[model samples]
Target: MSHSIAHQARPGHKRSEDGVLRKLRPLFWNQEGRLRAGYRVIVFFLLWGYGPALVHGVVDRILSLVMAPGGQWSFGIWLDPVRLAVVVGAGWLTAHYIDRRPFSDYGFQFNRDWWLDLVFGMVLGAALMTAIFLVEWAAGWVAVDSVFYSNESSVPFGQALMAPMVLFIVVAVAEELLTRGNHIVNFAEGLHSWGHLPAVFAAWLLSSVIFGLLHIYNPHTTWVSTANLVLTGFFFGLGFVLTGQLALPIGLHFSWNLVQGNVFGFPVSGKVFYATSLVRLEQRGPELWTGGPFGPEAGLLGILAIMVGMLFTAGWVRWRYGDLSVGRVRLSHCENRLQGR
Candidate 1:
């Protein structure tokens, strides 16, 4: 009735009311021709992360009762994948419909180079970890302990490799979706509304710190380890910000964990895992140098290794793309680049 009376007052009054509504409408959608990128970027994770996790929990309870352990019921072990997928899916939907952006804009596309990039990233990640291990061994910071759980699994050694790889693959994908996919890209663009390059740098710093915080609850947490994680996060973020494709970063994350725990039998950031044929490491030197129970990434050697990885990645991006800038790319652009290989 109030609306009707106000409308009846004058045709000129209706125009004024619409102007007010237009101003309010932007709270949900960016109608002012601004991206309001941050609002959209985190909205899905903030609002809907728990709902899916709750539903997944309930489903797992039912599955536990209905199926045999480590059979079809074993799917519960993969819950992280599902939990992270909910956020990724929500972001995808938002990007597709609300943002009206190509999927590639989010730094994803399955092309010829996709497999190569993934494999290369995996190798590079493993190599970096190996380098850290070798350096520590050479320096006598760590000693080669007895072989840990050497091929004692029901699955053969070759197949056992897949177990950790698969787990880390899910972890890598979920993290990429959370940080590089949602945080860095969205924050960069949103900050760009204020200034261009500075905005991107700010986003990089902010996301890297946030990424470090996310791991704070892990076992054997320390100031040194935490700081290393922050730096490592930045290192990973550089791969994406420079290449604008998450393939390298995703692979790096996956293999780093796989080799850290599954292959090398070190505490992966204070968390340990079991798998087939890999020698265990025992830190013998100063805790600060070896990271002690916290893992290599927390140690001085790990920090050195991470910085070197950053340099290598920067060099690779420079060689590949002439210059590294977070320029948006179309799906066709991604495909065209892959065609040569």
Candidate 2:
């Protein structure tokens, strides 16, 4: 595969006349004159791994000088933005230089169609979460304790509610960019020679596995939770695979976390949000059914929700576009440039 790709005549790539340059080109570059996919992936991971630690170290040192000893900042409020910056910066750099493509090619075009799909995704996510809460309630598995409760007396009510909202929004964008926007696009592009449908499916499945593994170390994580998260990744990627836009996935992700942790007071992926919740509740159902401390994503109900989400996403795509086919996720850089994208 590598040998074939090295020799293929890619559009816009002029073969070097110099013997040394020609010989070296195949080693470091593809037929398109861009860094090969494997090398690009290596550079991306390196930036993602080290950039956060370096930035955090410098920020921590600077904060230590001004703040009192042992004084702390909210993890969600403070550190999340730093992570967002690092992740977005890494993705932009990789797309612009290593991939030799427009950053928006990764399904982030801010057009009317994108925004409409985003709204649909957000509504679907909220509706699904509400269904989960209602189902548990009907089964007598959950008991509500209060509404608009805050665990911290020092924090104002509005601030408590707003913090998690901001956190989830930032989290949604960053995670979707890394997991769906960057990983899937690159994977599909790298595998384009395998054929479009095969490349898209393979890339989707591979990136979803990575997404599940990413949450393996979260608080109270279990095998069941991890497996369910793999399904969740597929659910989130459905819209992207169909429409090739990040808006749907991002909106769905944000609303799902916000409504799960803040609105209904569920432990989101095992991390309990103790600060504030609109409807505090206790679970009395069996752990297997209710997900216990790991939230719904660890339970059967979550799997059901994921299936429903996939169906709804497909329906939306069919309705909006009058066709239900995979988007051009496997379009290569040369192809994109020729189309003037």
Question: Cα RMSDs of all predictions?
Answer: 5.6, 7.7
Write down the lDDT of every candidate, Cα atoms only: 0.72, 0.82
- Model 1 steric clash pairs: none
Write candidate 2's Cα lDDT for 231-292 as tens digits.
89989988898888898999999999988999999999989765588899989988888888
In model 2, residue pairs whose N, Cα or C atoms come closer than 3 Å (at least 3 residues apart or on different chains), thus clashing, are: none
Stretches of candidate 2 above 4 Å error? 1-28, 60-75, 335-341
Q: Estimate, for each residue in 1-341, the C-alpha lDDT of model 1 and write its tens digit.
A: 99898778888777889999888877755533544666765664563456556868877777778776545423534554665566567768766765566756767877766666667678889999998788778988777777745444454566555556666776788677667766776676555444545666787788889889988999999877888999989988888777677888898998888888877777888987543437766677787777889888898878887888888888877776688675532222322233224
Estimate the lDDT of model 2: 0.82
In model 1, the runs with Cα more than 4 Å from the true position are 1-35, 69-87, 148-160, 274-277, 328-341
